[model samples]
Target: MAKSQTKTKTTKPPVAEKAADAATTAIRLKQDLRMIPLDQLDFSPLNVRKVAASAADDAELLASIRENGIKQNLVVHALSGGKFAVDAGGRRLKALKQLASDGVIPHDYPVSCLVEDEQNATVTSATENLQRSAMHPADQFEAFAQMIAEGRKEDDIALKFGVSVDLVRRRLKLARIAPELIEQFRVGELTLECVMAFTLTDDHDRQMTVWNAVKDSYHIHPQSIKRQLTETAHSASSSIGRFVGIEAYEAAGGILLRDLFDDNAAAHMENPELLERLAVEKLQNAAKVFEVDWKWVEVHLSVDYGAFRSFGRVYPQDIEPDADLLAEENALMAREEELAAANDGADWTDAEADEYYSIEPRLREIEALQKARQPYAAADQAIAGCVVTIGHDGALRVEKGLVRPEDIPVAAEQTEYPADGDTEIAVTRPNVSPPTSSAPVPISDPATTLRKADGISASLADDLRASRQHILRAHLAADYDVAFDAMLYALCEQALSRSYGTEALNISISPFLAQNRETLHPDTVAQKMLDALEQDLAVEWMTLEKPDDFLAMSALPLPQKQSLFAWAVGLAIKPQLLSDNHPTPIIEEIGARLDVDVAACWR
Candidate 1:
């Protein structure tokens, strides 16, 4: 046996020494330095360039000069006796002159002077001011980028300026920032923190993404971008629209209404009769948003005729579709009596032995040789018809925000599933749990427990399918809450699927049948809930010690097993409330004021 050696070399560039030397050199430097005489300092007269050799703000420059005082001595060329022209510090000279004019500084003051040899004044001043502090690291490197540009290593320039090569390396970084983003930062309303580094790449398409986000919303933080990355996430408009609907929408500070009947100004028109008719028209238009009956929208409209019109517009959800459609849609569905009449044995796939199969294969082969009994699969055409009916119902529930997210998957499944023949499945929905008194009650008796857990009983299959539906939908969400229906639905689905041929696989869902499994025993309730909570909820740990309603919830026959489904709704809504573009109340309180009565709202 042989072992291979993996060796990698680590490169270390000594940057700390250079930085320390620069700072030390800066402090020890000696020159005739003093605050310039305020009246004499003509900052505006000086031919200084823009900040950082680019468009810049006066804030940092003003702050530094105000805090530290002028540390750099101005080098000037001797023009005559007792007089000199500034060779450098033209910008500093101009600012000092401005400060003096504003009476912000003393009228006369001492100044640091670098009276250089006249012949080489420009050369000397340029060389001195081009040092590290006068220009930023990026700007400094840019000013002398020639050496690094012309085959010389960046380390050489770094050593020359007594700065780290990495500090100089970012010169490349600054240049690479998307020009669009740089302009945005310059505009003052936009921030650089929102823009990702990837968006700054030379790729113009990627650069446009950053540009588009900023353009759409003046302040697009990173989270906003991430949310856009997944279109499944709620939008500012869509979520509120669906949950509140038009009635709630108008109640909130959203949809504005201006209609004929409500307008007193309409009566003030010069032609009273015409105005009255026009007012009716406006009211009709206003009422349309609420889908009010024709009479409600138009006072002249009759209730009976309007009702007939409404019926024509509205379609029944539970209507069965064509028999052929069901057969086309669902393969498993078959008539119980007919299927029983046709069957002698179930179709079997014989197993062949190989290294992959082993002894287990032998068992499967023996089992295949034995008599096969048929297990019931639901009537396919009927189930498909139910699905079509349920789809609209689910949409209505979602539009009203009446159904919690946890209930969506299960509800969706329940809408589409049909009753079984021999299996005798029922859709059991939980009753709402009432608020508890100070003390908690014990659930010692089975009958008493079932009573308290009061739930509406429908077909078992529907309930099981609802749970499966929830699980499927839960998979769509990235967030995991502890009270999601998805997990409960998944658990029910698992039991139902395995029960077809394997009696051993059938599970007793009685524990969760009445009570909201998500609330009563969340771990056994919904996996989606756990995943959502793990993704979104901040664990306080203290809430864990509080009394749980599981015992009482379990006692009810079909106590709303989805009570905690409301809790998952809260989790989902919490993020919406806390988001940056949250409504005025949310913006003012920063999501602190979000405790609303869901039960009362629904009622």
Candidate 2:
């Protein structure tokens, strides 16, 4: 029954031809501008730009669309079903879509578009966006600045634009640049690199000063500008600033200019005059506090190498402290050690830190008091003074007891040479004549030779004895103490008359130990020991400039002279034996007592 009734309805040839002609006309006119429903339009997946439309731009587009309708039509391609995909004007499509979503327009509201075939979508998208010029960097910076001025936070602006907060801040730095430099940037006369350097300081005058100073020179670079700005102001991290402290400087009405663009936000001290004045004041206060005991105390902000040229140094004298004072000092030292030990295992709190700082000053004051107890010679004190200045390390430095060359006392000339009271007594003696080679001699028998001698032989014996005595006397005069010991030993040996070397009934040392240079090998260790000793001794040795100055050193206290002599003679008895040979008993004993390291000595 169904087969009998299933008749296929077909259009007449003329009607079909008329419908096909109508469709062809519609397809041919598709590229012409017309409005499509917003719901029917979709973004083209082949769009070249990935950035979404900015909020302000979208808002502006929405307002324009509401006020004047779409002035420029979006390029769209026919997609599956009845939908159209945007190719070139995705942003415009988004603006329209946002308007429809906000109910500013109907969801099915018409969106003006220039319809294209699907095959040309990618080429149309690329051509429309890629061929357009991007906004200039200067304009972008200025725009960001304007947004900021309009009370928009950097974070909010970055979020709205889909960019980083840091990037927005960086752009904002450029915006706040000197107006003149901004003008230069706007005209493309200044590079971005040099423009960034102007962000170091906000002072337009200073920026202009640096720019004008370097613009005509070969040093017109970002680094050059940075250096000039840095030179004009002192960094807060500088040694002088750190020494004076930021809080203290600011308390004294100092200004610190901060670098906003720097990642560390570095600060520069603008009030250098105030900083210098504070440093000098602190130094003067310290000098004043320490000047009571000093004959004269001079304060200097900086000491050049030649600053010491006009000054001479005076040696310090030892002054024994009272028992009560010594006990108190020892107690303070113990307390300081306890405090240091307490801080060893833990971090210090603010209070603990302050306590540590407080203790340090008291410890330094105690040290100064102890040092002040050291007495200088009256003569030195009369002409010498101390210098207090800032050290290279930015700490207070006290150079005590300096004497100028002009202050050195001149010695009185000798006037008693061959004077009336200084009598010269002469003693008459039997003249001894020099023997001549032609002098006659007499010989005696072998048995009587011991009893009788030739005159020439006796004279020769006397001459040899006299020459030996002269040599012995010279050695004794050089080291009288050593000579005294040697003479005593000789006298004792003669009294006992040992046959060690006295074959002819005479006692003598012969000074043979001094001649055995190689066997002793004292120079190997002595040289090194003497070098160290000389360095220690130089502190005192440097004081004596002339022979008379050394002689005048006797006016110094007994303890001072002994201390100098002690240091000088410290290496005199040092062990000098090498690894090649055994040492003398006395040398070995001394080495053992002193725990001398032979290998270390050799090294």
Candidate 3:
């Protein structure tokens, strides 16, 4: 019965037959090409490529289409209402739509498309995307280089390709890399970034040298390669380089090597010698302003703490202001207040804004005039010099009022003894021959003359003294009254006797020597405390001219005065352990008075 039924040859149903015929017809019409209107097209829901295009990609695609009409046709399926849905080339469709919206192309602009049925849309879209291959990076770099060699301007090429000028430059830079490096990149031995690093210098030999040295090691990083190539060069951002700007350097025939891949990285200057010379010349020019008012003016490329330590500093002195000057200052202040109030939150015309801002410079000028009036004493100016150098921030730094050691005045020796009526006793020490018989000899205490334990080595004695001094310093720093008294005594001794005698503290008012400066480790607790105190110190007086300094210092509050006094006195204290191991009686007395906790401080 089954054989008979099959032999009967049943006819297919009309609906099924028609469906098969329609599918066959759709397959035949799959490649149907047509000019679809921009406004009549939309993205297909069945598109397999769901990832959105980036803004840069859209811009580039749009630019390409604008420069050259669409080179590839979009795959689309017919929709109801005579509309079409893009199955492939979604980005291209987007760019065309944007152009139509921007009026660059008409809304009905004919877009070439390959029409397909809805059933095959997704498969067709996927095939179109998956089968495409991007141009190799090496080929891209070579193409860009070829275009450039053909006399095409970078800007024009960027415009034509819808890419950034910087990108074009980078591509060219890659192409110009040492041929050997490019080969390594082509063969996968080097990464794109490594190849880019080779473009930092144009000298192929130098690039090859660095490459050969690092290629075999695990440290063939881009930055490491750049470091080796530019080891002998100076960065444009360096203190000296910034001081002598790139423009100035270039004007002086200095060559700069730029990094095409990194815009933020500073360029390297090939002529370091030329840069240094320019820096010195610029500093010398800046020093000329001080040469007239100073006893001597010296130009230094960097701060020489050693040279500065040997010089004494003189501060400015205050002078009484004339009535006219006071009046002028008051007037400027009143005007400034008025302008500030007027401009608080109000939007004003440009003219009004200009007027409001003008008050600042005028006030600054007045302040400068006032500062100028405050001058160093003629006697100080005769001995003090100035040093001009570059600051860490690359600004011109002028250190004024530096008195060289040789220029310091020598105090006259005592030619006359105190009058017989004077009751002051003249002290005689181990070093000085007993004061003339005419002068009363002061009695010396046995306790003060005792030497340190005889068996201690010089080094051990110094260590012990340093330990004791640190303990004493910690305790002294906490007592303002004692530090002040000690400082006052030291100053009076120098003023009245022109010499120190059996002093507990070394109060020379001198900067730290180079060797001594090295011992002050920044991580130490003492140094940390000093740093904190320095942040709060009233240093406005230091910036004032000689005539205004005294007034500014006097204006400081009592607490601020005490802080400055303590800091100054603290710096003057040092280890009193003599090389000969002599007992420092004065230091011992100070420690006893302060109740210094040696164990607590030393640990």
Best by TM-score: 3
All candidates' lDDT scores? Answer: 0.38, 0.64, 0.71
Of the candidates shown, which would achieve the greatest lDDT relative to the real structure? 3
lDDT of 1 by residue, 44-148 (tens): 223343354422334434444655577777766445445556767776666566566677776575667655456765565556566635443334434555566
TM, every model? 0.25, 0.40, 0.55
Question: lDDT per residue, candidate 3, 62-105, as tens digits?
Answer: 99899888999888988899999999988898898889888899
- Candidate 2 deviant stretches above 4 angstroms: 1-135, 158-173, 230-232, 264-266, 314-384, 409-603
Candidate 3 local lDDT, residue 411: 41
Off by over 4 Å in 1: 1-56, 133-232, 237-603
- Per-candidate clashes, comma-separated: 57, 4, 4
**Residue 174, model 1, lDDT:** 44
Off by over 4 Å in 3: 1-31, 187-194, 216-221, 305-307, 319-374, 412-603
Q: What is the lDDT of residue 76 in candidate 3?
A: 90
Give the root-mean-square deviation of each candidate in angstroms.
28.9, 30.8, 20.2
lDDT of 2 at 133: 82
- For candidate 3, what is the TM-score? 0.55
RMSD of 3: 20.2
TM-score for candidate 1, residues paired by index: 0.25
Model 3 lDDT at residue 222: 64
Of the pair 2 and 3, which is ahead by lDDT? 3
